[model samples]
Target: MTKVSTVTIGALALTASALAQTSIAQAQSTEHNTAEKDYRVFEKTFGATKGKRRNHTKGFCFVGEFAPVDNAILAYSNSPIFSSTSEVNGRVSHKGGKNLSPDDKFGDRGLAFEITTPDGDYHIINVNTEDFFPASKPADFIDLVRALGEGGEAVKALAAGRPELQAYLAHHKKNRDTTLRPYEGTQFNSVNAFYLVNESGDRTAIRWSMVPSGSQGIVVETNSDFLMDNMNANLTNGTVSWDMVVTIANDNDDPNNAAIRWEGEHTRITATRLTVTSTSTEADGECDAVNFDPTVLSDGFVVTDDPILEARSQIYAHGIGVRLSEKE
Candidate 1:
């Protein structure tokens, strides 16, 4: 009886060991698959555009400063950008193919800005849109780009059959008010998930928006240079300010999904006040050489596990390399 019991116990232990090994192997396999998928998507998308300038090809650059609101810095991120003032370099651009002029009214608009803080430089690249397209995964984004590249025919073909593409298109609406109003009044969104680490080492997933301090200014004229002219005129008069408001994530939130806007009340703290004071049209402007990668973050802030964010860093790095090679 004792011998039979010992044999049974050994068999059970062996089975448990085998199961643990299988679990580890499966986890590793999944990780490997994800890495490969990201690599393939990066190559397929950005590789074709190598040597050409980035999609938001043309930009009007500016110089400014990000000043932290003293009372608003509690319980949120400990990043220096929110605790101290920092010099900033920024650009406002029309989104489309490279060489598209600021006057192009057909494409999306973007704000790419960098803050040089004591800890490190933090880059914030936002768009006028509230949500990102192909909002969930790297492959989804690759497909969306490919479909759009093929034009209306491809979109129509996929729109009926592909729910993923359909969902993306439904959420991806350009801000029509952007061109009609002064750029200062236009709200810019992070679009991607990011984490704000507090002093206790606790991390809170959040998305932020930059809202202009004043009411939206009406655009009297419709021209290509109108956006630029308004910005310059405002800067000459005084610094234009934006309030940084963050929406904290709840348990129901999906950090990996960029398409789903955070639902619920937002914590509207004035974390940092961004003030743009001057315009720079110089070929050697500070922002001209910078990649303005959103993944380039400072301490106390981190990008979430969203595949699109990971893939963006890789693509932007590749684009920068290609651009530099062309210059050389």
Candidate 2:
């Protein structure tokens, strides 16, 4: 029960009194109809790809959020392959072995999000990785929520000079049954919770997110061999964690897409008020992918493989945003 109720947002609430107070059998576990029509359109259709054995080895994941927003901003769909129309069974990078086509390979990393106080700096809207990543992993998730909004102590010194986030939290804390499986036909990786008011404004913080659930996101499988022969099955009980409503503009000069028109109208980001968990420790299967140790993200940011080929030649393809802390 983590704060979801834009009147329950269901039936993909494009609106109908919010689809009559939402509830098409829990509307894909609600969160403003699964965080904008199924979590960021299903991880911009599978984080643009780089799985299933790509010798570059590792690095490819992202998720973002920050609350109490005013110049609120959030925009995803960086376009690496949203439509040439099909094939994304592992997100991308066949390399020279040839045979790529999640719309002809993808992963050229380029991520941007901004919000610097002092009365200026407001440009937080990115997602364009239709495909590109000759070699990737330069600290994703929008560089860890702008490094916790640049606070003091800087996220425990970026968890002590990253070694790929300390070897991905010590290889998922003693092998979490080998994590990694939220990027294959998405479903239930929706959590973008952040609330900050630090800088000595009398304390208040929060951050957490999940967007590594690819393939146009929200896939949830369980045809049920009786729920996988009862292998401790819970399959997201009473799920729903959405509410990504942002609005904060200073005009990036809208020539129809550079977009910036806050004050209301055409502003959208809603998984419809949410916060629900029935005990699940973030991780899916066959783990490892959080990479951020270029000496703790080399001050102000530095992740290359050429932004994964510039996040697949930019425009916003591998669209992911998440800033978790909420409580330093």
Candidate 3:
């Protein structure tokens, strides 16, 4: 074909592609979007970064152990994990889609642990905040991310309409101010609720938090990966640990809305102590092969009615497949 004819054909192809893209975007329904939609939005916002989890892209894995603080937890959940110390894969990360993301940003922080128990493997991916994402449902969360990505007035407008989102952002900002080093006593919460099934076939609605032994404020800020720096240094000296404190939901508490924090005083129990003895880079660690699938619960805990909690499995699956398959 002549150069002019080839150029004309390429231009037409580009126009068709643009139209198709617009059509796809316009065809989407905001209210009824599914896990697949959430995955697509995530991929579009960030990318299929090689060898990294699509979200919580930046991480450090640590081989550790999770031991129950005491057998008092057995009253709530009669699982073997609560009865004996078990091996664990602990991962800490800055919540985002970019690998090697700087630790200086005021983003949500993630702390995940995969505990291999005698019964089965149990995974819990918690966050630094006391509450979950601003969006309650899966689709709304996708919308929140899209709006935040747009920045400027879009964030303001969305938060203005949703009080929960406003409260979440406010809490995130407050924690970001107080949180310094990752392993230096940074508190992480399992914002989603779960039901702890006891031996009597009774289930207790509960939420858990990893309260650090101690916390450090920012001593000095520089263009450095101080998050991991502090974590590694802490590990070299000795093991770092957190007390997993589970909070019971009151009779009036609403477990349906994961986004809403249960107000008023409640019963809290120190269930497990997770100790990190060693660390490795995300790509070089055993955690790279493990998906910290939060939905995978043993006989101890059953899934809650929270829509966001129900939605995590598929989103996580999509992420692991994409990141691991992408050529380095």
Candidate 4:
């Protein structure tokens, strides 16, 4: 009788453990599904631009220098990324898969840069908007992308019940007309939040923005390669610049949900300045050799729990894999 009881109890325990493992596997599968679906949908919607970045394929590389504002940023983090100064390998691109995307149209723009320091390299990519797409999760963003295939107006439907989406669309809609071209009044936002650990190990949640130094320039619709032309012309005259403004999040802020912008007044710090001195028309420039993966950070910089940010690292890895294979 005692032997029979022991055998039965052991069987029940094994079954329970199997059930727990199955639950964990299911959760992980869901996360992967969201990320994989995002990549597949992007391919379906935008098509493939072989040997180029899956998105933001249309861009010109440039070399520049970045330095923290007189070592003022050290109070927040001692990361080498914000140390004295670093060489910048940056790319300015239209936010789309079309390699020949024109500059005259109203679309999202991107500025991705790799900062090479003495210790290591760090990267940052920001969109030319105040906040990112108001998608709470990877799945929600994929749905928006699929909806986008239907048309721009169709995307508005997703905003109907969600005030957050509505406000986001409303903000962009108003800003679209006055939208600054790549080097103009464009203020590139980090969108996702990150935690910065100082020497003492105190963590501060923040989002950074690259704001053009001068007043917002007026929009001038020009030819397809006009923006690049303008950048070259501007460089001939003088270097372009932007202020690195970091916004500190309050305790009530949600570092996990980028879909919702942090509302109300908050502390803003001018971390540093970026100066672009030279432009490159070459397809295979310094920026191409390196993947500007934002998650790839130096010490003192830590990623947040934002699911969209996490998904980006995976999605970008898939992108680089396909591009590198094309080269081979």
Which number leads on TM-score?
Answer: 4
Error of 2 at 168 (Å): 1.0
Which ranges in model 4 have alpha carbons more than 4 Å from their true place? 1-34, 125-127, 161-163, 175-180, 214-221
Model 3 lDDT-worst window of ten:
2-11
lDDT by residue (187-212, candidate 3, tens digit) is 78888888999999898998888888
RMSD of each: 14.7, 20.5, 10.9, 12.5
State each candidate's clash count.
1, 78, 0, 0
Report the lDDT tens digits of candidate 1 across residue range 1-328.
2121111112233343453344345435555445445534444443333334456666677878888865555586778787788877787776655554646365566777877775545555554544554547776666666666677888778677767567666755442343455667677788888888888988888887787884346434657667667776666565577878777788888877886767776666667778888777625465555666688777778888887777776555445444544543
Predictions in order: lDDT: 0.64, 0.24, 0.70, 0.71
| Clash count, predicted structure 4 | 0
| Candidate 3 TM-score, C-alpha based | 0.83
Order of models, best TM-score first: 4, 3, 1, 2
Residue lDDT tens for model 2, 157-176: 66466544444445435633
Worst 10 residues of 4 by lDDT: 2-11
Residue-level lDDT of model 4, residues 1-328, one tens digit each, is 2111111212233343453344345536655455556777888777787767777888888888887874666788878867758878788888778989877776777887877666545546444555655777777777777777778777878767667677778877776555436554577888888898899998899988898874333334477767866766666655577788988899999888887778889888888888888778636466664556678777778999998888887677555545655654
- Report lDDT (Cα) of residue 160, candidate 4: 78
TM-score for candidate 4, residues paired by index: 0.83
TM-score (all chains, Cα) for each model: 0.78, 0.21, 0.83, 0.83
